[model samples]
Target: MRSKPLLRVRKTGALMVAAVIAFVCAVPLAGAMWQLTPVLLIPVVVFVWAWRAGTDVYADELRVRALVGSTRVPWQRVSELAPDAGGQISALLDNGNVIRLTGVTSDNLPRVLAAGGQQIGHSDQPPS
Candidate 1:
């Protein structure tokens, strides 16, 4: 059995609103012609992706989920959590692979770390 997640970082609810708006607008276009019916799938896919994509932080591991799949990284395998220029967080693994965290951001990185029971310490600071 899986334990409850300590933290779940997901896209803002605004994406759901956008998906609804897009679907509403696409309905008229889809109704106008049979060839355009596939257009309806766009908003549906977006809605599902927004609803499902996120990062789940557990005490012993991290689960990063996308629209189609999820990757699990044990805490022991994580070498570092890094932020990119765009402020998105990524995890560097001991195997030298980087996994971009779906919904984790620089601003909330500390919270994610805390949820995993990681203590924050500055490398520049001298040890007592």
Candidate 2:
């Protein structure tokens, strides 16, 4: 059986800020004047964020869908995977490409390391 990659789900700060702004803006329309059209955009944005956060990074391929665009990176090109203090994971490519995994948890870190063919004791700090 093929080993599935680690999946990370993280909330984007920008999305949270946007939701707050949308909520504030929709306050005035909260009464009988409320319509799902204007406020509906917030849910759409949240859904998009949720989808992006729940991306999977496997040994065979890296899949990402974010603000810029969607991309796939094969395992052969992946160089490194590291985690930052701010709780973000960075995937380094042999071609000098770096993709940040926004919502990576400790639980999922092991799977990511395994997919990358890296041992657990390879890092002094923590794996990305």
Q: Of the candidates shown, which would achieve the greatest lDDT relative to the real structure?
A: 1
lDDT of 1 by residue, 1-128 (tens): 99889999999889989999999999999999999999999999999999999999999999999999999999999988888999999988999999999999989999999999997756887888
Q: Write the per-residue lDDT of candidate 2 for residues 22-119, one digit (tens) a residue.
A: 76666666544666546756655665665555445665676665744667777677677777776567778998979776565565777766755656
Each model's lDDT comes to 0.93, 0.65
List the pairs of residues colliding in candidate 2. Answer: 10-103, 82-128, 83-128
Best by TM-score: 1
Worst 10 residues of 2 by lDDT: 2-11
TM-score of 1: 0.92
Clashes of each: 0, 3
Quick one: RMSD of model 2?
A: 6.0
List per-candidate RMSD values in Å. 2.7, 6.0
Clashing residue pairs found in predicted model 1? none
